[model samples]
Target: MTATVAIDSYFTPVPDEIEAIDLVVEGALPPELNGRYLRNGPNPKPGAPPAHPFVEPGMVHGVRLKDGAALWYRNRWVRTSLFTESATRVRPDGSLDLAACHANTHVIEHAGRTFALVESGLPYELSLDLDTVGPCDFQGRLTTAMTAHPKADPVTGDLHFFGYGVRPPFLTYHRLSASGELVQSVPVEVPGPTMMHDFAITEDYLVWMDLPVVFERTELGVPYRWSDSYGARLGLMPRKGGPVRWFEIEPCYVFHVGNARQDAAGRVVLDAVRYDRATFRNEWDLAAGKEKTGSVPGQMLHRWTLDPRTGVRSEQQLDDWSLEFPTLNENLVGLQNRFLYLVGGGSVVKFDTVNGERGVHRLPDGAKPGEAVFVPAENARAEDDGWLLTIVSNRIAGTADLLVLDATDVAARPVATVHLPRWVPSGFHGSWVPESVVR
Candidate 1:
């Protein structure tokens, strides 16, 4: 007999596509809020769940706002070869079909195109209306899996991203011109295959995390595990593609990076959520719905300052509480940023890194908030001048709400709460595409 693995609370999937028009708003919507708020996450088939939650099929939930009204809401499952085919098939070369991607991790817009992304496969293109446009190979130039988290430079409008695989040539870097052309792809040298989910970019260099979580054969569903033999380090590579300078750091895992910038002294500063080896394994098991083993460690807000001249790295914990899904002003990517927004521990928090002050907006009892996305106000003066948008799951009510809070005052009452029709399962990352980009 086999023990049962319980499905995570967030694994529940909606039965069918849904559209709601003229949703009722609890408060006033920002008059300048004109755009779409889209989030992507896993939604497995009704009877056939994937071996791991991360590999499940993707569903995108979106809301359109214009003229200070909730114009519409729609949810659609991304159509890919994986979801359409009756049987799993492999190419003649034995490589998995990139078209058969889950595309469940994130939805982003670049080069006038919207893409649904899963780090292990190619990105599926989608129209502004939230309709799947099928797999895209960037004009047949992208041959590797695309990272779900791609950073668009605020100044140059270029997109900087990378892909990591379980095979050799394990890491590759890609860059797209502001005009949306795949202009560069360079193979990055690393010791072994590690789970490189997210990376950061500074004005002068790219920051890569080569952690200890390596691929291993296993009888269980997810084959990747933390290895004591594999060491942890960070790589600094130039934008023009050259030899990478590696810096050794303490063994830990970083799933997301808040932001990175180069200080006046040319030192690289990175802020992220860091988890120790023990905490990472336990959290991964819990997310896979495996039985509880040891206690899970909290994801701490940490900062690393790397001095290239001295070849030394200094790390510090900025906050003691558990948090994840960190976001900052998109315009501040690769630049100095004052506030970092994150969701977890039943609240939306705003951390002032310079002042060491934190503000939290607590949700209703038994309710949880997803990632908080920042939308800058029209004619924005300050970095924090915007509204924070997120889906709040009301477990007690069996529904969800699109809560909008003032970015500068997160602890204040929500400026608006647009009711959602169903419970949204907890998923990964998402993006806010302004109407200017849509048209």
Candidate 2:
């Protein structure tokens, strides 16, 4: 008999959606934080769970802040064709239904539009109030699935993203202009289909990871198993148009990237969390509610510097401590960013990449923190001058909080704590939608 996937742990799905106004604030909220802290995660319906925790229907939790006050908090399902109408991505005739997706991974904004995203299909737009509008295909131009981890160029205002699948032309790169027009969609050449979740970008180049996690027929769909023979490599493609320059690197799996930038020497440097063979399989099994295996280390901070002139490069393990959900200041996405913020088991860490210093904020017992999103301060003076916005959930209390901490000093007390009405399940990725950027 097959073991059942557990949903009663920290990731238990909330049964219903509710709203609360005039939320109580524990600490002083900065008047400048006039926006919504929106997060999306998998929240499978009560009787309807997916094969894994990551593929369930998506539910978005949002907290609205205005003028130093917590105005309201609301939770809404993304209401995709899958969530509401029980739609499937493939039709009876084998046609693909990209709109029938679970937009349950991340929520981001571009070209004045907010969207809920999952890597398997098109994005579903959401209103400021957290209501799903619909799927966006850039005027029928996007023929493939969109990865949840799209990078928006800080200087160019252009969006860089890619999509991968089980079919040939396994990887495709797409770009959207500053005004939201789908400008370019190029077929990136990869050997076969892999779980290409995330990528990075610098001022002049795009970063791609072609790891060993391949797709095949299995009891659990889209199994993330490691393959020694497939090998691992990172690719660098010119934004102007050129074939991807592949660099053979260490074998590992990366679910997220902290940031990537170009050094003064014109080489591309990238920071991200890495998982080895054992660790990736172990973690993947635990997430799928399968039986856990041998003890292995969790994800670690790793870096890679690649040069175009010569295919030579250096790889380094930045840290041994386990961490995930790496984030940095959006303005420095593909530029010089010295500070990186991440979430650990029960604490948040701020890593100074240049000096190898780490500042941590340990939460109270039984508190699980989600991704830490960096929002630049109104009077920002330094690279770390911002507020780290994250959702902390306490399962014992059946509640959660929108915790805001100063980015420069993670050890310092929270800048504000907006009390949420109910407990929020551990979700994937989200965005802090500042109201000023919307209208």
Candidate 3:
């Protein structure tokens, strides 16, 4: 047999992106927030290798599929083999293993081909041949930190990922080759070493929130912390390198980093959710006025825009509800380009930002919407004719199904449903991984 290339062993450092910036935003975490649990959960121990089952379908929490498959990333708690055995629920004989679950998402594209996946908490790129159940790692660790919520640029086809890290704390980045190799990586500078909660990137820039506070491992072995600001500020970085501009979000704790979209006016508008004083809480049993925990009742959407030319930012409040996860389907843009979308609390509302009004569309009763994938009407119409893909799980059903809805009419109903054989727990992040893009 011919010798295989030792990609992982070769360590040639490549200079990274042209522009980058760290921004501090105002935001505090309540006990109930998702990040707190990852740090302070009872189990910190890693687990065994994952078992890729033939029948047990996969679902990603914070990832979306561009073609039809979803990029699912698991934490350390749910062991991989366990994920294979009892996908929908925990088994009595099943033990929880963190290591097996702590992996990036892999794509099993058509014709038994497997594409590599790069995710947080991993040192190197993950090359998974799902058909043969073989896995490989690329050279040098791309991220020593646990990256969170990576979004793929539909146009550039680059995977943009960001998240929390330690060791004087830093943000890490790796630009992957089409073959899924770690072509470049470097220490990405963020303002204040603030824990980057989540980030979204479009063709132009990377938008994220930096909360000031190093995460501490709780006595119970759970990682947790209290941010300096009840809210964090928003910042922007060109896909390249430069001085990062940090923007302050007034009157609200901009805890969660949402979507960054550009309007017809060439202005960039960032859509996110902020938990005010009433909605913020604390936990960790830490003393000295630090007993805040649990999320408040309602959540709202806040939009901020910056002039591309002058870098001047203008802010506005878009909509208020129990609104959590916000997605804008800018498939068509005209004077009346309607943004077809949905919220975390389960309302499908269309917003005409140009007009400044909202049209509400409700999902089928009892269908809980998680992170939704908006297949622009243009893309959806070309391949699948026209259908929006979404993963919805019902408590009673104990399963997550890939549901497709008509992009034009949110109230129309699901066009097709691919029932996932396993139960994917209520998760925080997810994305759409299209098959055509993967090699």
- Go through the candidates in order and give the clash count of each: 0, 0, 53
Question: How accurate locally is residue 415 in candidate 3, as Cα lDDT from 0 to 100?
Answer: 54
How close to the true structure is residue 278 of candidate 1, measured as C-alpha lDDT? 79
For each candidate, give its TM-score against the true structure: 0.96, 0.96, 0.61
Error of 3 at 296 (Å): 2.8
The TM-score-based order of candidates, best leading, equals 2, 1, 3
lDDT preference between candidates 2 and 3, better one? 2
Residues 1-439 of candidate 2 have per-residue lDDT tens digits of 1112333577888888889899989989999999899999988888874568767889999999999999999999999998889897789999889898889899999999998998888999998888888999999999999999999999999999998877777999999998999999999999888999899999889999999988865655654567888999999999999988999998999999999999999999989999999989898888888887767888999999999889888899998889999999999998999998989899999998998899999999778899999999987999999899999987666668899999988999998898887778888888888898896
Report RMSD for candidate 3. 15.1
Candidates ranked by lDDT: 2, 1, 3
Candidate 1 is scored at a TM of 0.96
lDDT of 1 by residue, 1-439 (tens): 1112332375567667888888889999997888899999988877784467787789999999998899998999998888878325358789767686678999998977889998888899898878898888889999889999899999999999998887778999999898889998888999888889999999989999999999886644455899898998988887766677888889999999999999999999999999998789878887777787856769899999988778788999999889999999999999999899999868999999998798999998757898999998888999999999998876555677899999989999999999886677777777888888864
Specify the highest-lDDT model's number.
2
Taking all chains together, the TM-score of candidate 2 against the true structure is 0.96
